[model samples]
Target: MDFRRTSTALTREQKLAVVSVADVKAQERITNSYEDALIGQYIEAAYDYLAGPDGWLGRCCLLEETFEAYIPNPGGGFELPIRPVVDLSSITGFEVSDGAGGYDPVSAALYAKSVNEGFGYILHSGQSSWPISIGVDPRRYKVTFKAGFGAADDVPSPIKLGIIMLASHFYQNREATFSDNRITAVSRQIEFGLRNLCGRYRISRDHS
Candidate 1:
């Protein structure tokens, strides 16, 4: 099984557009410069929650990273081919360790047909169990995979809407929500609206 660490595909400018912030020119001293900066932060926050680690809004991205599959239950056998993975698109590197401090690359053809759309990969080596030790450390079973919609431009509309709505709401209401002088909760209506829009993007193992 494989797990991954992903990077955000949205840029500050693209995020600003999502939240409907006024674009600032190179040397323009906009009156709401401070607000603009805050808007960027809010966008970051929205994206972080929506598409960060375990986030469900699977935006498309390039092959940015690969990670070791830290399988927690090697004793459980081959029940889990991919470990709590994000939206995996393709595998770039698949290597197994000999448990004697040597590594061998697994052929792509072996696992190519095992990828399911929403589920993770399946290992089919005509064997009942997967290799338990892919590395000397037993935790370095590794496969580099790609995931996301394809690129930032290809982010799903629902996800983009969620980011815009959340960022705008938070920016407009930041004062009361986080101000030292006037700490207050977000209104129920606003809370409900944001939840309805953004909560669907949350990844839940219980009901996913």
Candidate 2:
């Protein structure tokens, strides 16, 4: 299966920012608002670094987001690529009818989702199997779903704290490796602390 993000919390005001600008300011002990914009960028960068498929954790963060997963050929069911899936919006099976691509929506009654821990799996409701694709299309089946830990309040404290610390680090260090003509390494303590805080939530995947 392959996954692509279709929408994000940024699209909705209420779902934006797992950690706010004020949160980062407080973490860095900033008492003014002069660098609020830059701090906000760092906050977003920290979030991108720790969340999503390419993130360190390889998982969704707080707030709801939509993703689309494509399956070449489905069996009785398949796992949704993103973790902590909140809802399966729709599943559509693709076909080549009259030499043209066609999409048929699977009935909600014919399937169900099973969420355990943060993993999500879609299963056929009964003994039936999923419809087969007619051709060799790579994206034969499309699954749209919402995934995340939920609202800001539902996010774990460790993850939130980790973001704050990471953003603060970015705020203090403008360069990736050098400052004042001298090489600088990222703080090992902060790196280890982030790993410790987010390690349990990291998703290990063997597939591309």
Candidate maximizing TM-score: 2
lDDT of 2: 0.70
Q: How accurate is candidate 1 locally (lDDT)?
A: 0.50
Per-residue lDDT of model 1, residues 70-166, tens digit only: 4433332232232223443455555666566556775554443234443345355543445564324634455555554444555556667766666
List pairs with backbone clashes in candidate 2.
none
TM-score of each: 0.62, 0.80
**What's the number of clashes in each of the models?**
6, 0
- Cα TM-score of candidate 1: 0.62
Looking at candidate 2, the ten consecutive residues that score lowest on lDDT are 90-99
lDDT of 2 by residue, 29-102 (tens): 89999998888888888887887777777765456677778777666777777777754432322221222565
Cα TM-score of candidate 2: 0.80
